[model samples]
Target: MNLYKEPLSRFLISYNLCSQRSAKNFVKNNEVVVNGNSIKDAAFLVDTENDTVIVGGKILPQVKHKYIMLNKPEGVVCSTVSDSHKTVYDLLKGNFNETELYKLKCVGRLDNNTSGLLLLSTNGTFVNQLTSPENEVEKTYFVKLRDSITDKKSYVLKAEKGIEIPPENKSPAFISKSAFIKWLSDESLEITITEGKFHEIRRIFSALGNYVVKLKRLKMGDFILDETLNEGEFKFL
Candidate 1:
């Protein structure tokens, strides 16, 4: 964005090619080429919107922003790269190859033990806006409880009355948004929330003297998880 007048080294850094110091070194070493002309000056003016910038031997591909809706499977972390656990990106490895251009990030994360609908995008702005609490983006989840609450109506009433969630690091307990609860069975139901606190659903249930046995996201804003897409499968939107 607005990269035309920026310095060559700054441009490459913004594109995550390397750290600022590393970018300067890359330029100084004559490892960067602009429009087929090799340039060693890190401060060389660039027209990134139009002029091609090449590193090593390949031209940096212009990012064609991608939006993906993945049916995240249980045991998969919602991250681009990880050292221990399997990540959602691993499921999409073969679909796209331009990692430098398209750095897809999950809009919001699902717990590794959780499964279901997850949204990812190459556009950082879109992800920020969609995940912002001010936007009040609603997310729906299907949860299986370890035990029945006996009276679902009471559970709804308690939630509607507002349950106070413990704050981080000894901060004051704050009341989170009241969830819209819909029961499918004695121990299964859907809960919709506009907030994205850490382990929010599990915490909510825990506060109510219950435990979540299984959790799966079903809907987010205007998009619903396609039942046709099996776990770990994804489709572009």
Candidate 2:
């Protein structure tokens, strides 16, 4: 009975039915029907909870959102579909049917080699809120450097002061605020950052003239990775 208004293009994207560019085209071609009426405007609002949407003549069921936490292994990619490697979604095959699983999307992506806490959810708002840079959500990682620590005090100072992201890095230029770094040993440490820059942890060490031997996410905001779950294992939250 309640209305859940969402733009047609965004709904298509959230449903994984089409990419942003294609969604517009799909709508323009009248391939999408909402409540038995062919909708051509991509910006047209539809009720996600109550509207009956059909794409390519197939009904799109409206289902409740689900939240998931996963201990991602090193080899898995953060993608819905991948031709070369296993995706994070593939790990959920045992828990979800095709329709539900396809609706679930990664909250924030972890690179193919980076292992640790990965969040998956069907709630678009939840994913957007967590990943938005403006939210200043804290993400902590356990890092192992390739070399021994020469000066613990200096490393902490540089990281906390905000390391200058290199020009080559695709992430935004500004580091939001100070990061917290705790040295566990000469080669291992824990760093917490509020910004989700691409290869952020790795780049910080690289700017300090070091290499990251390993990196694993430990926490994101209030959601911490469940330590009990083994690599590649996931549980519904």
Which number leads on TM-score?
Answer: 2
1-237 per-residue lDDT for model 1 (tens digits): 221245777677777877877877777875688888989888787765578888888787654456789999998998766888899878988888856324888889998999999988766556776788888889999999999767999889877777988765544567878788999999999999998888888888888889999999999888799999999899988
Give the number of the best model, judged by lDDT.
2
lDDT digits (tens) for residues 1-237 of candidate 2: 112366778888877877988877878875788998989998888767688989888988875568899999998999888888999888889777899888888988999889999998776767877888888888999999999986899988878788776754556565536889999999999999987777777877888899998999999988999999999988888
Model 1 residue runs over 4 Å out of place are: 1-63, 98-102, 167-172
Q: Count the backbone clashes (under 3 Å) in each candidate.
A: 0, 0
Q: How far is candidate 2 from the true structure (C-alpha RMSD, Å)?
A: 6.8
The lDDT per prediction is 0.82, 0.84
TM-scores for the candidates: 0.71, 0.73
